[model samples]
Target: MTKAFIIPLLLWANSTYTQTSLNLKPGDTLTYSPRSDKPAWISIQSNEANMVVALFMDGKKVKEQDDSRGIKSVERLYYIPEKGRKYELKIWAKSYIERSKPVKISINESKNVDILKGQFSPDQLVEDLHTFRAIREQVNSGLYVYRSKKQIDSIYQQAETETRNSKTIFDFYKVIARLTGFEGSCHNYTDLPNHASYYLTQKSEYLPVTLKNIDGRLLQDSKGVAMPLGAEILSINGVPAKEMISRLAQYYFSDGFSMPYRETIGFDRGMLDKFYIEFGTHKNYVISYRWNGKVDEVSLPGISLENFKKLQESRHSLSFDKKLMSEKYSLTKEGEGIYRLSLRGFDFAVGQEDPAYKKFSVFLDQMIDTLEKEKIENLIVDLRGNTGGTGAVYEKVFTYLTQRPFRDSHYAYTKFNEVPMGEKLVITPLFLSNGVQDKNGLNAYLKQLYPKAVQGKYYWADDKNPSILPNEKTFKGQLYLLVDQRVASAASHLASLIKSYTNAVVIGKETVGGYYEHNGHLPLVYELPNTGIQTGFSIVHVIQDARNLPDQKKGQGIVPHIEVHQTDQEFLEQTDVYLKKVFEYMKK
Candidate 1:
């Protein structure tokens, strides 16, 4: 791939109009000004094999385009240009760039401009309404997290009522996203469908600053000089910031709410941008914020989309706490007889070229060897930021920690034995077919259940067999598990297993993807036929015993034995607040 570079040029100069062009490579940027007051059309044609283009208007990303149908992606934005206002067009190859592609970009006064106007036809709006209803039906039937069908139906109906009154495609996107959130299932989300994605990209605008819900307050996270660091947000464009986030949160989780999950997904740049577009695309926002216990208001101009994206990247790079969290999966010596092992994720494709998976295997082997060689006493398994993948990814780690038997999950159940697959509804299969062959009796039982698999009926594993495999080098030490809300899916299952089968004290926030009712194994994505809004749901429902709490309620998060919360001071200082608590406990 070629290195990044930017070449800027002035296109034309006249009393009525002025234009600029930029030659962009991977990670490169270019800014241009619209010269005329009339409606302007910006067009892009790139020669790169797979290029993704991002369009920013008045400092906010309005649209993005990607390669399509054997053609390098071509996209055009049409909008009434504000004279002397600047717009940005940035391009890069999605994977890698062998060489800089020749891109032809131009801004011209449009002759026929009504097509750029933002309004869907009555027929198109009707089609989108039907699509939204279908999406609601699919969620009501397939999602395994809900306790009852009535609960799911109620949430879908709310979305249905909103969809019926929706006029534009952007309005439909907002409503569908809200319903997806109501499902309260992580990994299930909605986005602009392919047919309508291009039309809205050129017109949408978003709130410039990125935010995080910290201490129940919306705080601006961008390190830009214009905004105060960790400033408490009060309102945006006259609407209360909390009210705005509450509305946006509807598109994420309905129940089983995780703060980390909500802030990360709900308050992201794209969703915030879509929210503003769905409401109204405004150039400048009047924002109210609080700093040092005093309230203040400012008219903040929206920053470029690329600028906001770059800010997030910079924050991760600069944060010391995040640096300590990264190693993918590694074992490190903190002090004599004490070691900290960080396992970032468990999502592995088993036999794929997964570095995290390969490293986890190697790390476990080395950890055992080290434990055998040294008189290690405390081993801290860090699962703080793990969002989960495959549950069996850490089977070897389990072997070194246990001497007796270990049950991964109590049992798994599904609403349907045979569920239809694909958008085309091809390859319907029984739920038992999704089971992995780790246990002997359970594997055999699953195969037998395959023949008796029935549709639209709940099915479950009959066998509650425990896996018994102790590694030769079993470490007899005090095991400590470090976890937080980010620990989810299979990672959450592993947390439950550690508490259940091994002698370990879990320390941190209550886990979001809990033992009794978190969904996994195999998930399916479905696209609404008419509007093309995509949503996904998990088929298998797994129940595992909470390690320390024997009587934990269904869908309840695994409460930590020693709860720890990050103070704002600790966060800014990049302190290991959770680990510090563990250190103090060991000394005691």
Candidate 2:
């Protein structure tokens, strides 16, 4: 991890060629080239079996650098150019029976490269900035913020320097990681496919069965149709399941997921498009199953990459993902013709002033109007997917539903600062004042003071919450409020309010379970060792009715009145476990 020498030598190729020779196999040489301008990609093609290609340059092994060969697969590509200098190349076979000749290379050419582009998205930049602030706050709040303002000034200066060289969004992801304070969180975090249209694409081929947990060396499939999930894998086009896992591991591990850092956490959610395997070392090539082996060996002329992605999204025989939304979060007519609407995930691409926000507001209004027309029994507001937003347009929504004017009673609390904190913060309750003491005891105080409160516009206090029309009723029918571990922040707030006031049945597992008041903060915070990440700070705390909720660990998440658990059998059975529970409760 040398700082000055962190810059890699770019390898460029002018042309492309598929190897007639099996490069990755044992005893075979695997090598390819890329264009000079972007010198990065390498093609590993060799006749050798289990070809182990290791890149050793200038007496140093470049293992951390991203290259071909799976996560564990050794690659023969160098980030630094060996233009004219002597460099070593090692390509060996697994069994040690086959290997490749060490072809010595020279590095003489040097391209006069100028400033590299700066890359980072607005949210990513804010996240990076927030990181530095957290570290500074923890290390010595006085020295970092109040004393000299050392960290802040330094970060602003560095960001000014880097943005001049960032290129694509990927580059943006990289640049911010390299910024201040991000340390562990900013390592190799790529905000790929965060956009509505852009899906994060893994480099592995999508296998037939959806994988749950790959314990030890055994591979388990959720689609129960297969007895021993691992046993059905059969072959990599008749090659072997174990070999396929090796190829797949490159993708799973390289993702740097499961990292404690906010930025480098793993991405098991996004799946790869497709896989191309040649069994028996290129003697036979077969495309893996896309829809649970429903249609194998895809019958098409020339397999293209676009078609490959389509096959993956087609959920034919897959189990439900825990974080996904299905029937539970839907809008439907009830006995009285009232609407039972369950919302999840911040799927709405709404902005405060944006038309999308207005559009969403209108959608809510329409739902209410429809319920009125249908003369429905009552509205069941299910917020299973509300990961949270500005609550985005909750204000606009409440107006249409509530019958009378209500003042926002929820207080906007915070530890006075220059930034606006988003309501989703882990805060320390400093101004419990006399209110917290009124709670049942110390347990309630811990939940309130240490970190529980939002200083945002998400919730409307009793006064702020509009009153129902004198002629109207409290969602007259049974309001089944569905929630889960995924319900968090604003969603949790809604769940809390629904549970406490309306006495709504909080169904599903515990919520991702967080609630508080906060607003956007941090003009920026930067990570120290981590790159391409910017951070920020904010001030505000959301302290809803804290006495009632459970402690911040096991019971912290909003629990369901009627509980439903995700079963191991569901993966194999492909049953809507949670939904089945929801519907069952609805029927009862």
Candidate 3:
């Protein structure tokens, strides 16, 4: 799914559309234009099941939806319109259709709507839950990656039982999120509906303190009125710190059996958001903590979202500025023969011709040129907070690091060639514009790309798993890889490649991404019927080209050869403990 699909789903609400009754032939097209600049929900229902709807803004194709599954008669689309911009909705029958039918089209202009307080009956919630389950079972290739079928069924039963008591959309969201997280794929997640998220931002009751988890202990990273920095939190609002962490951890998604990822998310700024969801709004907090050598209690008032942001900026020790966050890669000369390349992220464009990809390619080329000219003997690749991006970008980076030929993955597979639940799936506009408009088009494209792929079975993506030679100017110096819990997806893939094929010394905490295999590649997103909640999961199950090291275990993330974590003093002083370890290792 695209950013437009995900962001608008959380920021907009549904409304009644102007009903229009129409009778058209198979080849005829019906165009509906909105009168205002507000977001609109367009719904088209046909007596037959071959209606294709396309959205055009400023004469450019924005999105296209064609639901010919004959399952649901209505096809819905949501789009936010710009002022003075011309938008048109084009509806037509598929070219293969021989006959035409009566179609009912409606456009609902979205207004200021509050879905936070919206309540659903037991039946409505259950229906949505069933729909969610059906979609996952049919489309998610990694549904049983970590858990057995029996275990998944039992979890679903538990979710259904909990759903019966859910009144608000937020309540159901928790049940769904917990279930999604339990699936153990980092890519799987169910986001709260837009209005509910909006509701959170408007409320003034939120935990003000930022936290850091060092070796399972939650410590205050920010200075509060009564608690000092590095104070160990024993409890909050009478709930034991251990119990609270464990309970809130379930709401976060991580790769199979990886605890560090959940721990990282639990103690970061996400703590405030997850706390509000799990424990509800709080005006004040009774916090018990250990500062220095004594344990004490503190009563602190909750801060608003605005105030929390300000507090994080002023007091949080690990808060990053906008420039730091935006940086993709940086290289610094550490010593006479040592250089540290910090790859913050891998979210560059995949195409070689694209400006982003070209820039990244040039940066790597220059780094290699410098290494050759300066006679740099040691290179440290620091991937501390990288959270993954384009697989091709990582592959490109690996080419410059390794002298031997490498394949991106050992194997990659998906459940289906054609998209399952096409009627309910929210596809990106890029897919549609590239001729994948409906089930048949998707099937044809998949078959063309993966000629050996079969329907209703695991189709190995061999075409995408081709081996390639190393770059001419591959780095030949001694290498060291620095990774932490925040390293995931493509970033972790790079770590896995380096650890597997090269003699690079691996250090720092275990990565959040799987070491051997993970559910990745194409993501399929669906919106729940009742709550309008969007749930997404990656369809491709990727088995990476990794060596079976004793430390790298199954159903776990990339465990470094030398596992190191931040100490209390280092955390408080905002020191790079991993780099300190690297320098310590160099002495030997």
**What's the lDDT of the predicted structure labeled candidate 3?**
0.74
Backbone clashes for every candidate come to 10, 112, 3
Cα lDDT for residue 174, candidate 3: 85
By lDDT, the best candidate is: 3
Worst 10 residues of 3 by lDDT: 1-10
Model with the higher TM-score, candidate 2 or 3:
3
What TM-score against the true fold does each predicted structure earn? 0.70, 0.44, 0.79
Query: By descending lDDT, how would the candidates be arranged?
Result: 3, 1, 2
Clashes of 2: 112
lDDT of 3 by residue, 1-588 (tens): 211110011223333445444455433576666554666555555433335679898989988985332212345566787777888777765422111233343334454333236578999999999999999999898899899999999999999999999987778988998889888888887765342334454556777676667778888877654578888899989988888778778777878888887865766655546666787768888899997879999888887766776665665555532433557798899887999888888876856666998888898899999999999999999898898988888889999898889887777778777777776665444344455545666667766554555555565656657897898998888999999888889999899999998889999888889989999877766667776666888888888889999877788888887888777777777777777888999999
What lDDT does each candidate get?
A: 0.58, 0.38, 0.74
Where model 1 places Cα greater than 4 Å from the true spot, the runs are 1-145, 194-206, 254-260, 268-281, 316-325, 348-359, 415-418, 421-468, 545-551
Q: Which residue ranges in model 2 land beyond 4 Å of their true spot?
A: 1-210, 213-330, 334-339, 345-353, 396-409, 413-416, 419-474, 515-525, 529-539, 545-555, 586-588
Clashing pairs in 1: 18-35, 59-303, 62-201, 63-201, 177-251, 181-251, 181-252, 181-254, 347-389, 499-547
Looking at model 3, the pairs that clash are 10-194, 17-107, 17-108
Best prediction by TM-score: 3
**Candidate 3 clash total?**
3
User: Model 2, 59: alpha-carbon shift in Å?
Assistant: 45
Worst 10 residues of 2 by lDDT: 253-262
